[model samples]
Target: MSAAPKHDVFQAVADPTRRQLLSLLAESDELTVSALSAPFAMSRTAVSKHLRVLSEAGLVRERKAGRETRYRLEAEPLQELRRWLDYYERFWTNRLSVLRQLVESDDADEDVLEPRGPRAVD
Candidate 1:
């Protein structure tokens, strides 16, 4: 049988907790559950659940050592997210550039003219 559709990595990363975990993992190679939990006020179980979602999305990996499971960031899935967002980068850049121009331009007449109203319907 064909392989099942992969889970949506971007959607999985939409959570703030997951994003924070990813950031921490990226900075440090591997961190224990307690170490990861120290920065937030959440319970260890809640952090574990966040890690589980990230693991399923292929954004992180957990390795068992003795009684502890260490979590590490896997950057490959993030590259996929970056590639997806690259498509829209130019559109946002263009919009921001226009906004910057409007805000920084020194031409007084340009700002004084109110935008024209739509033509009356027939």
Candidate 2:
């Protein structure tokens, strides 16, 4: 059987350029390729390539306006990423809480076992 296409939200956002593109799109309703390329040192073509990756990941939507092709952020796909990260966030929070309790208990035990009086000379 043929393998399914491998494009995914994680892979799409993995590149710094693509992440910047997403950030730019998020800040505005839509932006043209030229507008998106303004703040970057890369060429417009490079910016478009990043946009294409976002498009494949369903993290961006494109629309034609007159002579310009405008791109907009599509945030629905990010819900999956957020949910996945939130699960790990809770997991780490629980682990840290347990660790804190253990450390506090150990400190209390150490205090109880420590000698309070000065030692006598032999």
Candidate 3:
């Protein structure tokens, strides 16, 4: 099976603002839109738009909190990315194991070789 997905989680997270929002949400359980946008030098509307895309991707949830709406991180969708990556992780592990074996074999060969003067190369 192909390892990584052709899906667009990377695209969704491409924006610096969106990444910041995700980081903030990860640090806190839930926050109001105002709270989420507090660190950014942007308008409420702009932040809301980013939040909307995140919501559509199942990465965030918005719910009415008294008069203000709060955004909560829905991290379960990250599992899709992880599952897609699992195959590649296994492949890399196998490749690294082979590299380690090769390196160890090289060391063993070096130990068995008698000391010799450097060879001249053209």
Candidate 3's clash total is: 0
Give the per-residue lDDT digits (tens) of candidate 2, residues 5-119: 2568989878998998999999999999999999999999988888988998889999999999999999999998899899999999999998688667845677555678998
Q: Cα-based RMSD of the predictions, in order?
A: 5.4, 6.8, 6.9
- Write down the lDDT of every candidate, Cα atoms only: 0.86, 0.89, 0.82
* Model 3 residue 122 CA deviation in Å: 10
lDDT minimum window of 10 residues, candidate 3 = 2-11
lDDT of 1 at 62: 94
Best by lDDT: 2
Off by over 4 Å in 2: 1-6, 106-122
Off by over 4 Å in 3: 1-10, 106-122
Ranking of all predicted structures according to TM-score, beginning with the best and ending with the worst: 2, 1, 3
- Residue 107 CA displacement from its true place in model 2, Å: 6.7
lDDT of 3: 0.82
TM-score of each: 0.74, 0.82, 0.70
Predicted structure 1, TM vs. truth:
0.74
Better of 2 and 3 by TM-score: 2
